[model samples]
Target: MNKNQDYEIFPDKFRIIMTGTTFAFFAIAIGAITLLRTNFVWKILAVIFAVLFMIAAVRIFKELWVKTPAYVINATGVTDNTQKVPVVVPWAEMMKIEMVPNNAVMQIGILAQKTVTSQTEKTHVLTKNLFTNGNMAFYSVMIDGFKYSKKHFLAIFEELQRQGVQHNPKILVSGYNVGREK
Candidate 1:
């Protein structure tokens, strides 16, 4: 695909399937909880789990219903359309692109000249605590194995590097096994 051309990334089928399974499991759990023997603590726990599970299911359903592109890449920059307020990262603001290894999964980290802003920025911080070790405010894009294999993601990453270089010769692009320590 041409780097200058716009491309829309959709969520993987595996994610949708897993989300459906989770919703079904939670729905069943709610039913099972009502049938459990009398126990105050168990009932309280059930209520908490029910609420959390329902929220998760609703969020997943909303994502499925919206059918919006997860990410958009073009000549100007990359836009994350998945957030409440899409984040537009201009090419000049992109400092570096690194592939960070995490629990056998690799994520593409887009380091920016300054912190990127989004409506869900705070949510990113909370989720980052689970996936990253550093405190930097770069944007992280997870490549779903079911949607795009590792090789495919790497290719896109390389293309992004090429685009960045074409747009801004000084921008640093690394982490494609070049052995530059992070």
Candidate 2:
């Protein structure tokens, strides 16, 4: 038996699958929206958004395709195979991890950049992915009335909390969006 088989459990498959399916649905939705709406500006925007959404959906599906069989081994530290962030997070740092509700609200900080008006410097800025999952694992960032079955949200949150507790770390718990709240 593989020594790491214990921690070799898969990531949140349902979320991955749901996200992929939703993106594909969105691709269709935008096309229909454009058809129903007669504004030229809206048409142009819809087509652009649809194309970009399709491309991103394809990319996400491809990544998940290969990552399904992967696992999160937690022998000394937790190594998440499914997520793209730091695969291996030491127990200490993981304990310090906290989720900021409405994280995109932090982007409001960027607007301040306009007021700074720095003319001589450039810095690498990571823009929020407005169209992506909206960081669903922490549901407060979700759009209003966005729905997910209770089981789905419970499963993911519990797993993360389980891991956090197992390694003697703390997990950040936040409220869900109004319509999506348990």
Candidate 3:
């Protein structure tokens, strides 16, 4: 690989990885609900869990779908297609970037702003406060349309670090679907 060449890691295998893991989990949860629905007392719990699983599955599907080119990353900053608007994180203000697990386990950082429902409107969902992220320092930017997980992601972050990105890298994530995967 040429040092001068700008490498764009596309999460080449992520789609396959997640489809098997996340989507499968959701399907299994749905299956469990079906299997347990026969029990009168447990039926309600099964139904609820199944619903939650289905919701999660749909989210995973949404996350895995990609309609853009490679994840554009460079010395200046990184850009993502998931973001509705363009986000430019200047290298000067760049802070540390790390990969984290998403879902309830850990807070998702460096990803698109999550959507929230509006309390004022009974039938409408509004954007939840995106600025107030969870206590967790960084969120793992989910890269879709891949067939695997570890390789490309690992390489991207290592490259960023090699380029001297420090922790809490000064980031400006004010965009529609911007994110990074390192």
Candidate no. 3 TM-score: 0.49
Where model 3 places Cα greater than 4 Å from the true spot, the runs are 1-6, 12-22, 33-38, 80-84, 95-148, 162-182
What is the per-residue lDDT of model 2 for residues 43-86, given as tens digits with 9 covering 90 to 100?
88888888888887787577555644343435454444533432
Ranking by TM-score: 1, 3, 2
Q: What is the lDDT of residue 145 in candidate 1?
A: 31
Cα RMSD to the true fold for all candidates? 5.4, 9.4, 9.0
**Residue 27 of candidate 2: its Cα lDDT?**
84
RMSD of 2: 9.4
Q: 62-135, model 1: which lDDT tens digit per residue?
A: 66655678777678877767456676778878777666665555666676664444658657644763445344
Compute the lDDT for candidate 1: 0.64
**How many pairs of residues in model 3 come into backbone collision?**
27
**For model 3, where is the 10-residue window of minimal lDDT?**
122-131
- Give the runs in model 1 whose Cα sits over 4 Å from its true position: 115-152, 176-182
| Candidate topping lDDT | 1
Model 2 CA deviation exceeding 4 Å by range: 1-4, 34-37, 68-71, 81-87, 92-182
lDDT of 1 at 167: 78
lDDT tens readout by residue for model 3, 47-109? 677677766667655544555644556665455444554444445544434444433222223
